[model samples]
Target: MCLLLNLFHLDLETLEQSNVDGPYEPMEADATNREHETEQGGTRFSDFIPLDFEEEEAVEEAIRRSLEEETVQVPQESRSIKTLTTEEITGIVKAHSEMVVTEGFRSIIVSRRNVWTSAIRQFRRPRFVESTDMLYVTFASDKNSTEDAEDLGGPRREFFRLLVKAIFQESGAFEESPNGFIPRLSVSHVQNRVYRTIGQMMSTIIVQGGECPALLSSVVLDYLLTGRMFDIRVSPEDVADLELRDSLKTIDQATTDDDLQRAIESCESWRYQIEGLPNPVTMDNKDAFVKNAIIFHVLLQRKSCYDQLAEGLECYELLPLLKENLPLRVLLEMPKVRSDLTADVVATLLKPSYSVLGSNKRPKEELMVVKFRDFLNSVQEREVEECLHGRTLTEAEKTFLRTLNPGHILAFVTGSSRVPAVGFQPSPKLSFVHNENKYLPVAHTCSNELEIFVNSKNLADNDEFEYNFLVALMNGANFSAV
Candidate 1:
């Protein structure tokens, strides 16, 4: 959970490094639209592909023709006529792997600087997108790497991290809160379709087998999912305006009419905000006034924003899934800090492939692998001391220490900081990196494979292996080519 927070904080630093910060300025909207138009005119994967309508019609026509004339010949020599049951038919089709339907891959290339804009433009392009299309991401910066299902995982994970920051922090679509972000009441944002686009991105991430946003207020998610707000409550601290919240807090704590009147007079907005309130408030109705204020500020004010966000979420058939799948729904709104990527869970889930194992006795290579496993378990046990009184470390040393953890290793190998609710597909692999000269660990994130240096000389050099592994993971953390 702390790692997840660090990941978000790291994303913010990336945004700052890219020289892009804050909400969209009024003047920048036109420039963004123009850039989007340019993207449409530039080279696009969508242009080569035909629209869904034409393909569907052609497929249907072909199927109709084939069914009308096709006939199957069955041998009738001394055979009893027995009807096949539904289960039997299903079993027959299940036997053939090719006959089963599988998710399609949707490949997208995006610039790191304009990830949100480029991704949305590609999503909106006229093309057939399967509801369950696995999103394959490629950052424009990575020019040498080939696009394959295995190689896309790292980029895809990083894409979600960046998109989370872009939509919530950079887009200025929602108000920041300690619990989660609440939708801000903004007519201009709604009119610009900001909320809807962000909603579509959120749903796209989920359907494409990526990380959930998990940054929305629980109340907001409940309303969006069920279309009803039940047992909804908001903290007084959730109120963004410091002065107004303090005034309400004072009013709520007031005992007598004099104290209530004084508290109410402190805030000028109370003159018109609450209706039918006695000028000199009494203890009897103070609670009711506070409740109304809370409702007005939290729910009623952002009603339109919520509606727009809901519309966006329904973009890629997410509504039904949210309604039907309890776990997914919970995960989508689960707080970022609630992630359960503990060391034990990650170590248990990793699938290792031994390079040397044939005799009854354990191979030295196997022992080194076990040593590496023990190191992963101890990652969280070791305190990450970034400060040493007044001494400062070199840049390389800092990078090495910062990334020496189980979470970073999991992310380095799997492309996600948190474990998926459904768990990892093709479980993360532990393989040995055999070289005469000891080398750092290499992670092929696309295939979820981690290669540790386990050569003959380095089998017992535990400290050397640890140093090389941490340095390698840190060096390649942002290198998405693998």
Candidate 2:
């Protein structure tokens, strides 16, 4: 196939201009008459006329000589034609092909005005034509239209070229043909491909580390300009990592002592990239990302500057948003004054606190207080007992619970008052018990509240409500003017 394609490139003009001469040919009419008489049902190009014995012998010998020469030369040409391996071809196609609205049947006229003057003037005229339309179709133009159309064509072509380059960068290929390997050739596809490629490349660079600051800055700028980082498919893991790196750059660029101090204080231990980090610590978690970013900021400055970071302690309340499992095992590993303090620690330190009250001491009332506290703490827990009691929670109540923690269950008994403390213990038995109470009215209410809050917030579908609430809270705190 490739050989035939190459051979097809023979210059017709050059062939016609060749000096080769042969026996005189018959007139077209005579040739046609003979062809009609000997209609052998073959193509006109292939039809041949009878020749004299001597002529036929000469022709056969010439043909044989030509065939022998062709067999020898063809292989040499084939070898020199610059063949690409399958992988190379795949990579090129994957990198470059993008769909564009190159040709369409639409006509539009665009105009621009000088900002200083209120005068409007004609700018450019653009017209789209169907694919089958003749190439170089003339624009039937008035004087103004002609000038405008010509002027527009230059910029339009340039714009398309830039767009194609951008698309190439995004898709990681240099070709624009639809038959190229990259899928989805529309503007949307290009945008998405560019966004994804940028993100992936940035991530790879970060992981590799020691990248040039200028390159890093360019990547960051590209992300900022495109606003593609906020798209749906962007992995939270990538966002968190990039955010930390960008924040570090921001900290490094801090000119004021106050700014440096703020940056140092915001950094936490989680952000440090120690060599040979432990298994659980190295795993990808959104909380881990936030924690690492915070740590990275802190470690970048002098230890004495840490004293200025007392304001950052408030973020400790958002620990629940960092990880879903409550009572988190990490919390349990920490020193505690009392067993009940586990609940308090989770409430005060983490975003959400879980309390299983006994059947006394105003169980429902206490539950509401605890539930409200969870909301304040940013921990959302559904009350299992409430669901078992066959009551439904209102939207307000559900939203209130969502403010506490997401994906947390508060298993309460109708008459229970002394809430049981299960300190960050993970057990199948407990999970079963929790699942059993999931359908209770209290559980239903809390779940409904979370749903309402989540809907109202307009957070991304994959976003955990608790995480968003924490982010909002942190941003508010950080940006707040005292």
TM-score of each: 0.69, 0.16
Model 1 alpha-carbon miss at residue 152, Å: 5.1
Writing each residue's lDDT as its tens digit, candidate 1 over 300-335 gives 556656766777777566766555433244334534
lDDT of 2 by residue, 1-482 (tens): 32432232233223323412222222455335434533532211100110101112332342233222211111111235444322232223222211211233233232111110110011011121112111121122334443223322222221222222232232221211111111111222122222232233222111111111111111122122222322212112222234454555455556665665565444444333332222232223333443433332222111111211111211212122112222111111111111111133223222222234553323433333344344433342344223223435456445544332221222110000111111111110111112221221121111111111212222222223333333343332211100
Candidate 2 lDDT score at position 88: 34
What is the alpha-carbon lDDT for the whole of candidate 1? 0.55
Which residues of candidate 1, in runs, are more than 4 Å off? Answer: 1-102, 124-132, 142-152, 229-231, 255-259, 270-281, 325-328, 336-340, 355-362, 382-393, 399-405, 479-482
Q: Which ten residues in a row have the lowest lDDT in candidate 2?
A: 116-125
Worst 10 residues of 1 by lDDT: 45-54
